[model samples]
Target chain A: MTVTSSVPGAVPPPSTEVGPRIEPRIALSIRDLTKRYGSVAAIDRLSLDIASGEFLSLLGPSGSGKSTILMAIAGFVDPDGGDILLDGQPVGGLPPEKRGFGVVFQGYALFPHMTVRGNIAYPLKLRGIRGAELDRRVERAIDLVHLQAFAARMPRQLSGGQQQRVALARALVFDPAVVLLDEPLSALDKKLRAELQFELKSLHQRLGTTFVNVTHDQEEAMTMSDRIVILRDGRVQQTGTPDALYNTPATRFVADFLGRANFLDGVAGSVSGGCLTIDIDGASVRHRLRDGEPRMGRTALLALRPERLSVLAPDAAVGDRNRVEGRVVTSAFVGSQHIHVVETPLGVLEAHTPAFGAGVLRKPGEAVALAWPWDGGVLVEDR
Target chain B: MAKRPLSGEPYVGFLLPATLLVCGLFLIPIGQLVALSFGGLEAPTLRWYEQVAATDSIHRILLTTFRIVGLTTVIAVVLGYAVAYAMAHMGERQRLALLLCVLVPFWLSVLVRALAWLILLRNNGIVNEALLGSGLIAAPLPLVRNELGVVIGMVHYLVPYAVFPIFATMRGLDGRLMMAARSVGASPFRTFTDVYLPLTLPALFGAGLLVFVFGLGFFVTPAILGGGRVVMLSEYVSISVLQTLRWGLAAALSVVLLVATLALIAIVSRVTGVRRMLGAS
Candidate 1:
């Protein structure tokens, strides 16, 4: 279910009526942000609006300016151009401390000298909250991260996951309006990272705070984010809901980045009724236009997910359209599914079959027929 | 029995060479001094110890030595922290220029630097000449041949030593931690105090102790700048040994000075790990 939440602390309830009209309920707006090191531009003109209380991830490979965007939001890296607005106020010139953001760095960056309790209590002390109230807030933050038992221990004495929790608790102690995570789970093992990913998502739901995370791991982004912004070469490739980007990727980059896909190069044919036929080499594969259809005679690239393609069983009739035959070159059993590599006339393709289900295993060099529904493919403009 | 070179011999072999060097160079001299302090010139008596401990001149010299050392250390550490902070955040060209500024004075001959200060601080020196030209002063000011002059020269020489260690530590510090602090709603000053300062305390204390100990044995700067007016322990000992040929008294005073400086270093060592403080740049 889609959920909308009132920000826990947008304004102090006194100045909400005097402001200008705002859209997207944007918790953080990075507008035309750019940073350069000498001659190399680290971040080119990038603009994105993050809805309040939503988990938005800036997903990119290394040097794609994902972490730079996160740091700019945290007010650590000053952009050469563009302005960052938090709740509709320009925050470009503001120092990091005045930004009031909570950041979980890649390595956690827990104060090594401080115990878990001391680390969490730091922001409270900075806010001038002390004594019993400070202790209660610290305790609440510690318990929120499920690190109460380890509060008295030094950060070095804790495990990687526990240290990450302490880092989270320390960041959240003062109840910051927004939290920025810079690959906070990249240091953990696979199992621990998976566990913390769930914990972080649940914590975001419980706290109702805007979270901007940066990661190169597409799985982490797809699993935890409300919206994922795919970045490449210091620019935004696409931004949308995970399903939207997955199913209707705006470009070939997004389609390939979000998940694995097979692309079919073709020349666009006529659009009769709602269906459009594309001339793929010598084979004519008909597809239904969902959103943006390619013009006639334009070279278009069709993106089809591997799982959507199915192998037809013997004595079974082929579908009305979008059917092809290929030879299964190799197949391997992978726990719950059998992964098959089919050598098609177009190219080699992959398909996953249920390992436990009633499906005849296709041995190597077996001639097979592959068919996909017309609605299961996306037509991306060749750029 | 022929030993199989001790199973843990490699580790010991690594530590042994350095340990032997330290013992031969440092421990032996201090041990000899301690032995001599308890011995006597005429006979094995406690008379020189009693005289050295009871005399007002030696006591005054000791007080002067500590005062100079303490003041130099405090000022150098504070100024060094500022220089180190500047170095840490400065752009490449600026950082190089500032580092050159800190090191050039340190590398210059101590006597030349002291003489240069004396020339600037004397009655008809450039400082008074400028002040007179600007009409800021009616007469030449008293600067050299006093405690102020000695303090100035000593602090100048010690500041570079202090800055290097603090700067080295600050450079290795993760800047992201400070960014994290600021993100948690701290002001720049508050973040510095709450996060950066505490992280760099070990280096600061270490630099202070190192500068202070070095300041105690200062011989050339005090002799040239003091002009016989401010008699630090080193100058006093020089006078006793060379001018008066009072060997017994000079040895006793030298022993006292050595012990006091070593004691101060030991006290500082207790505050933080000494090996680390000295080992770092």
Candidate 2:
């Protein structure tokens, strides 16, 4: 892979260390898109602006309008209202072929009758490119996906991962303005899915083309996308960087969907020293105001990640961190980490601890104190 | 292995009745026919086959049969493909409606269907009377009792056969391939020609072969619609047997027709494997 990087016009190495580079120009903009079948709206009035050369993922479960948004952008589904703009030009009037955006379907959708070279050369041939120039582009695409050896093989003969690579190559061969992928890797096994996820992310970095991916897998979205748009019930629940969405989710659905979150329901008592104290049953818990300021005497929910809570010994010195006493309900060893479910006064809180030798293992029915920093718990609004 | 009693018999015992019925009903009759074509009991001579080859009328009859069958096959396939494509893309209820429409003719007897066409297509028939009344033509056109009538009747009868295989293949086709093609910048027309047409080629060939082979030996529709003006191979064979009592010539002609059909199937199966041609996938 490194050897080809020096070749002219070849893809450069994927920048693994740096974060997503935010470009100045917007490549595509979707405004007030709406699509309905019968009485159910598949895509409600949703709007989003995609930056150039950014890897954006629409992350959600099935029927969450993620795939609908991708299809609307690719011009496969006609929106009832609103417009889609490509480089500041309205493209809703154009057909899918004229829109000039490539898409990789869920099943790869490779031509079963055509060879790999023929499949990759299809779009170029449609544009009247022929002979030497066509061959050059096809060869370059084959090399881009590292499938030169399988250029003569049919789609059915290739493995699932290889077929996905061919699909990726074919989508890129036409030099489309943006590529839309609709769950392209969901067909593979877990190990191959992880491998292709890394390759897809690196491929985006090297090519620097705008990519729009729709997937239900939160981990995949977090690992590959520069920005994630969390959708639910045909509406945009939240949109932000992976870190922001994971760390400070704006809603209960966003917090629960992104990771394992333990919710603590309480009534806001009073505000003191930039912190809001909430009364859970009779115990008072303090949390920093991150998402929004809580109103006095109003109910609120706090999202605490399992990994954020640590089990502390009874004799441990308590500092500024919020502490709670609970009885261990059950604990399980999961190779690198141990998950303990504890019954607390507020609710059953789950804590994840590293299986390192530094901590003593807690047994079932044993009482333990759980502690977390004041800023660790995020305030989220109930849906 | 459970070591059942029938397992060691290689399953031939289960096939006994069917095998005996087929041999008695089909194979023995064919063997006797072939033997009769060689001048039965006369030391096996080629005089009957020679007589058939030497007859000028036989050449003309073969030509007419080929022309009619070829035209009917092509017409049925083209029309059937359009109907099948429509059905494949329709909603479930609409698709079922179309399927019933296609199957309605199959419920009618072939002779009844041919007689119905004869009533509608003959001179002074409903179609001609309507055309003459509308002043579309100055006189009643020749709509039946000719090659054109034979082709029309034959095509109608063969269309259902042509539709089944192509429709099966179209139903099995992944619609996403067409979407992928469009997404890759190919126009809708190009996507149909490049992706869809190629994928369905095997089934089309199978349907064409089926219609052609069936039309080759067709008897009822051509005899009724042709009104004795067009003498196809099957009708000639019947006349030779029933009218003239020329058993040897009839058997010779029948053998030739059978050989031609089988050879064509063999060649097509070699080109596209039979399973694939039948739209297995």
Candidate 3:
């Protein structure tokens, strides 16, 4: 996406948001994007290609550079070294207004002075879209968010969810080629956040424009994104589909961040065929390695999901392979499942056992065997 | 207006002292002045009002006052907006320096400021001397003892009053709104005109009203700088009360000035809500 000099009058292609569903293409490309504040780097050498008509989320914790990347793409952050491309045209050094993007901010950023109808019509008005055409498009955008009833009301009079909808309508009313959302639902309460997430996802589906969202909420990213890019310390840790990242995380950070993970830090004992055995304290646990994975002999790490571990009776004969004995630290029924905290020789681990009809949960201090299938957890980078 | 006083009716007693103070110190004198403007308790007359409407000198004075105050308010608000914008966007040290520059002038006594302006703006003053020395002008120019001098002095004095309210509103504005405006395809100029300007308008209107109202009561700067030739309403009132001993005419003029100020507020409040205008004012 990088080019030598800035392109003067580089008009972005017209948005397909108003037309029939256009074919999905590469909508945005970030190449070696780097932004630093004195000594701290907010985004460091990060590159990502976002596809058109895809809900791509930048998922990371605070200070992990998720929001920074979104801001850079939105032309708010001037990168020290990098280029951003809109449909293969380098858009670096351009002012945000010339970049033609729709942004949904976390605080909603609704104009306190403008009513919902006026707020939605503002972008169109800027473009010289006037009269009945402007009104029609504004009403359509409002209808998209189901906000016709409150169209004339001011932004302050609306609730958080309604204000967020108005913000959404305002952003989409102009029909930009891409929309960048910065934790747009983070300010709302839990139930409202969930409801808005569904509404936002449905809206994205209906309008086939590219959506680049940034959020720290892992569940929000997983539930809404077509592709999730996990970031840590301003570096791309992993990027894949939701299930691909959840089922096969390349690093402990990814596994632990994307969902709950039980890390077994140990030393690699030996490799037999495709399986590598690791010594966890005194007991040994065998892990099946993936193709192209190098043979390991030093300290190794494995991330086992809690739901993958099955709870069994103390002296149950389920074969010792991939099995560990531990004393139950605590066991409780959470309506749908029985959660067991087991203190094993390696470390304390949790196993979410599916609850049967009135299943009796194991008591604390009682011995139990935790077993999993042969291909249970993935080998993650120890860090 | 609530079903019951949410704050409790007993707390209304806390306002008794302030209410008494306002009625005794402010309302009583204003009422007495209003009574004096009309002819006395028994023989009420509109003689002063008729004289005010008839006198050509009084009309000239009132017109001069309006023109000078109006021009000064416009200039002060414009300069105040520029200063507030700069202070809002500046770094800490620069902002502090700008703040001190504004505050230092505010702390100076009005008499001191007026006398100081007179000294600087007089015919053979530093400004005229510098211009003369630079060969920019053939004559020293009538820099003071004129209406322009009065406006210059008044703008310098009233700018600080205009700045603080606008500065407060500017500082409280969320940065994300600007970014949002830019993101929605508004050029920087368009953003300013469409969003930023409209949003700060309440404060701007409030500053204009403050500067205009404050300028109406301006006595020292105009009296000192105008050199008695450029007699504004306040100076006219002073001449009526002191030199001519025309108490009824002075009181009538005062009533007119108060009504004009109130009318300006009413006009602005009618357009923007009273609560909104007052909130920024």
Candidate 4:
């Protein structure tokens, strides 16, 4: 499947268009990190290297150890058997204060007793900054987040979005080596969260500080990150750019977690010229083996994204596409797209089609042919 | 109810019992004391007030009372803040155990606790014996029957009061603020001074006010531990009434104490807002 804009015309151009590729320098390296709580490993021997000035996100579901990894990097949670290195220096023994990384907590964690200016001025003041220089830096930080007008207000006096901006300003004011965000936008409403997601991406581009965000929202991770790390059960499932992960997921969990996927269980019949022939419910299915080595006579699973499958009229030309006859069981109009659940010989398959003007939508119980290219299916390891 | 109002305002009847109780038990006695302080209701005069103002001993006693109360409040609040901070950061079982340790003195009577301290601090008591036995001093120290004994007893009594408000404030504090501060490059010491200490100020002030007000009216501990030497306001009032038969002077002193305490509470509430001063906010 290709990386098509999920919300067409609603999102701006992708962030990659603004800059050419630059050589990446390693900023922070987490080596062989392990943490356990009474025999249950929260982070089990995880290692990752974050490049300088790159926006990376640790994305996973609850209990997937994403937050634990973020905490370990932020020096809040001590790892049992690993070292965190900042700029090639081992900082595992350093306290969080000595680590000198900015962190934006989930709840915005702004000081309630302090005004916005005071909150933003805190880290600078701790560094013994005072007078005009401090004021200028604090003002610039507040201006960075567009919170100039609300600088005099207390945290409780501001709205949630405003509080989030204050938190952002406070975190960025110190100009640390990296900024760690723990689901910073998760507490916001949907509309505000989307707005901040766009703003955070733009801010990262403007500042060019290494940002490591932890979130369970797949769309959020995809929209704001330069690379996404998918984790499950204290282990790294896949780490790649959002497009790469979406188009070519390495495992069933990565495919299922990143977006919707339809799994077809089949037995491989033969392999010829890099193409694997499989039998699915007495029907011959062909899948192009891209980076996988599937063995013959073994059961295999193919992950087909719903958007890659198209529903056609019963008598439509198949034309070298993988076709299956199915009866439409349910169809839903989701404004921008139509989702149809079709009962087929292989099992139930979900298909998504863009909702254009006055298109023919198949009704329930109608016989329909679902067609997709052979390359649309990716061989994914079963979890 | 004679046809309750339809506006949904709080019913005055619900407050009637508490109001009657306060007026009967608190206001009337204070009113009587004020009236009696002015040379009784028959010929109300400011003779006792003038006499109290003229007496050097009354002035000295008032100064002594202020000193003891101020010292006790500072000592109790500082000690209580440490205990409360420790309790706030302890694990659940440890916090509960520390809380019990703080509160056990309350289970015993104030006079009993004062007597216990007397046994420990008297010249011939265990503390002096230990010190003398250890060659830490040439003679048995004068640890009791003075200002030191009274302060020790009062601070012990006031600490639990100080702990409750400060602990409440500490518990209400969001600990993540400290983490955020540390992440932003503030050292642990700086974080405490910059974030934690300022956030817990309201609790400290509230606890200080509580301890100070309670110490102002203390009688039992001072009477037991002072050994008739440190003449605080309460003991002086009792001496005037019981031994000297100066009922007017005693009444005057009581009126002054009541007025001073109320004025202090009013000023504190005005400064910090009563809800915050009580650590309720």
Candidate 5:
């Protein structure tokens, strides 16, 4: 029963990727956390270390235990086992209020009865700060969210984005040790979400407060997080920078979740010159192995991104790229890219090209060749 | 109905039935009551109103009515708030059970509930007998036969009125607000005062006003529980009509009670409705 929750791709690559250049002080650490509801476990034995002032995102689909992990860190959920530490001190005995970690709920839960000014002053007043100091702090907090003029308005009177800003201001007013956001931007329109993504990122930069965010939106996680920990069934599939996860996903799930992917099944061949040559449907393919040793003689799975493949005339110069001949089965123009579906001997493959410089759209049944670089694909664990 | 009306202006005939019913059933009767309070439709007089303003017993009765109704409103609202909070947070089964606890008694006849309280609260009743058996009192306490019994009966009858409105508002509130408050350095008690209590205040006041108006018109409970000693405004108005045959005085008291209730409704709706209970749902 526990085998389903185990991570087969737990072995990460050599951890020498140059991330943030700071001292990398550890701010929060989760150790062997486990939470179960009756017979089923929402979160398994998960461990994570967050750096000081780092914007870390727990990325996973619904019921993958991403929200449970965030709730545990915020002290809204009590784990059945293991411990949570804040700044290297165990905080298992603390409640949510005493934990000193601010949380922005998913729906922006603003106090409807209070004005914007009153909502922002709530935390300060609870801390026993009053009079001139309280007023000055509340003013600063409201100004930080750019909502000073609307301070007298009730929460329902404001727009959704304005209400979100007030919620954020209320959380950060007391200078919490850490801030947890549970899908903060999920309630906004797409354009507003994109705007606030950068706005929130810059806010984190200016404050230098450690932020732990939980989101199922891969684009949102990639846009705002300094590091991403992709979870599958309550276990970490991979934890790396956004660029690393996008380029070299450790599992088939991560690759498929992050972006469009083409999984090619092939048998592993001999390794030579830092390349692993494999045979796919009687055609040879080559992939540059980074640091991990190749799985020799066993069936291998290669994750090929669609944009890395290019369509060519059947008689064009192949150069050093791996080429396969096929017929154009479908063609489309999707805003910025011209997508072509080519049926080859191996399978139906796709190629995306820049829409502006892309010549003419390939018609159906046109003979074409698809070529990809040797290093464009990565070896991902099928598990 | 179509999306738009057939004409730009309202039909005007659509309001005929309800308007006619109101004018026939309500306005005409109220006009007659007002006309009777002055001597008659033909010859108007202020004698009954003058008598009311000058009499000491009328003043005492008005004061007594306000005091009893005010006390009943406060107790019922507080108890209702507590019950509503529990209903809002408890499990589904428990919440349904508690709702039945409020609703079943609400559906019971007001006379039946008043008598039930009499049976439990009277001297040598279950409460006094139990206390006597436990040696907690030397003699049977005067639990009924006065203002205390009247208040007890009225509060019991009015609690369901207070619970429904408050509970409906509580159900609409987002539970995340409580969590958000705690996440922002507010303890449980502080979160209640700072967030929960303030958010539900409009509903509280609304329920209080509803209870007060209903308590103002109460007659059966006070008549039975007051043991003929604690006569409220409603009971006095009854006496004026049935016992003394003073229809003019009865008509004047009825006008005063109705006007007072309407004035209170207007004032409360003004104060609590200023914000329109903005975002109350």
Candidate 6:
């Protein structure tokens, strides 16, 4: 099934006069929603707008309220106080079935008594689609998930990955306006999760339907989401494009959560034209601000990525940018790269450098200089 | 795996008593029952079988027994499912309170409970008194000495047994399955029918069968509540053996009742997995 939107009386005049309208419509809008179970808040005041046909991932650790947000939007858990709008209309009081959203739970939750065909045909049966058309849609759905050979098999008879596919096909069979997946790939192995991640991304593209996925794995969010919202303790840490979150984090929590980050605490000495001069161990270092640069005399935490640092020669006058003198305490070869732990005055800093064809490796106690460019550092608030 | 040798002899000593009990006491009685059904000192004959089949009142009594059992089973199952569903979703204290309420009726002696129902449903009982005092009825209703009282007492006895199995099954079921169904465009009622009801079918069948079999052997409620008007199979058998001194006819009727109970149990087991349903209950 294909989804094509044709706005009446809004046609293009000519090829030169037409510009692209690439952004999809907003399918679900959540505004200031909060839900509490007992004394602990499961979902704090969180607002998010999911665009139509866009695959959005709510990535966090356990108890970070990713699943709570999904449940709130699905109308399973009523928020203590806020509203959820679907397609510009309020639907806070509606039940989950009235929300018209398909959900694939963590374990797939396929009816064990139903065959593959019967499981896929359940939603259609509920909508009163019977006889020939029902059979046709069921067959099409089974084919869509590539489960033609297992159509008559029970859910338990299929492998974990196969059950997950059947769940996806069943969720999409009835043409739901949006699909919410709750840790759908968690039960599968690593290779299967990676494979299904691409399949889910492509399925979103093929169906042109909005998708909201919840997962604790950050890499899965980075690999699949059009936009990623990282949550912690029932509050959203940050929400942005994957690259934006990776390069520029607003808080130390967001920086440490999304990827590996080495935080350096120092006093912001001065600020000049988007650059902060910080005094580190009696040496002045000017670091360029990626975003949210701290003010003068304020305590600042700088996030430096492991891949951005390099081991330089001790006596080499490197003009690249900020540099620190340290000794390589330990190093390990990791196939494609060598992960080195350099003992510096700041602390033990991790540096990853590509292993180029039998090159000279740094041993323990070898004197070296750790250098990273100014643009590689991000100034984050002390959170 | 091979058995590991312990520092003591294999448990031949523990098995001696149970084995001797089964072979002597249990087997002897059953063998005697079988022989007595065929014949006793008057030589082998079908006289008892003929006597049991000849009486038209015996046939009517047997029919009444089955009808009361079947009706009680149906009513218990429906009400038990409702109560069990409510219990499954209730808070811990509420669930405990409901469970206590269910057990109170079951814990009371069947005779005592039946007497209580008689007191409540009699012509000048609390129910009729209340209605008459309120000017709702001109005359008292025929409630205690009829089929309705028999069913009411039997269901009150059997509902706790029915509810425990069904509630156990419902509690073990994954609540997420219902949520999954609802999120897939199913209404609350549809989710119940397509998901919750199907998952709980085994418990329903098992509980229904248990109540039905227990109903078949019912004696106290019907004997007291039927007031000698609606005679059931157990009461009739008692009269044939105890009052009329007809051992042959009683033996024949007892054999028929045993066979019918066994046959019903076998059919129930086949449909709803008898061994699993009745295990340790």
Say which candidate scores most in lDDT. 2
lDDT of 3 by residue, A351-380 (tens): 988899644589999999888865787877
Candidate 2 lDDT by residue in tens digits, B208-257: 99999999989999899999999999999999999999999999999999
The models' CA-based lDDT, in order, is: 0.81, 0.88, 0.86, 0.87, 0.87, 0.82
Candidate number achieving the greatest DockQ relative to the actual structure:
2
What stretches of model 5 exceed 4 Å from their correct place?
A1-23, A363-367, B1-24, B274-281
| Candidate 3 Cα outliers beyond 4 Å, as residue runs | A1-25, A272-274, A293-296, A317-321, A330-335, A356-367, B1-20, B39-46, B279-281
lDDT of candidate model 5 versus the reference: 0.87
lDDT measured at residue A60 in model 1 versus the true structure, 0 to 100: 86
Model 2 sits at a Cα RMSD from the real structure of: 6.8
- TM-score pick, better of 2 and 4: 2
Pitting candidate 5 against candidate 6, the one with the higher TM-score is 5
Candidate 3 TM-score, true structure as reference: 0.90
Residue B145 CA error for candidate 1 (Å)? 1.3
Regions of model 6 farther than 4 Å from truth: A1-24, A270-277, A280-286, A290-297, A311-343, A353-371, B1-32, B40-55, B239-252, B273-281
Q: Residue-wise lDDT of candidate 2 within A152-220, one digit each (tens)? A: 999989999999999999999999989999998999999999999999999999999999999999999
Cα lDDT tens digits, model 1, A215-321, are 99999998898888888767777676777778877577778888888888888887776878878778888778864444425776888888887776534576575
Clash list (residue pairs), candidate 2 = none
Report fnat for all candidates as fractions from 0 to 1. 0.89, 0.91, 0.91, 0.93, 0.93, 0.82
DockQ of each: 0.60, 0.84, 0.73, 0.77, 0.77, 0.69
lDDT of 2 at A188: 98
Q: Count the backbone clashes (under 3 Å) in each candidate.
A: 0, 0, 0, 0, 0, 0
TM-score of chain B of each: 0.89, 0.95, 0.95, 0.95, 0.92, 0.89
Residue A255 displacement in candidate 3 (angstroms) = 1.2
Model 3: residue B211 alpha-carbon error in angstroms: 0.8
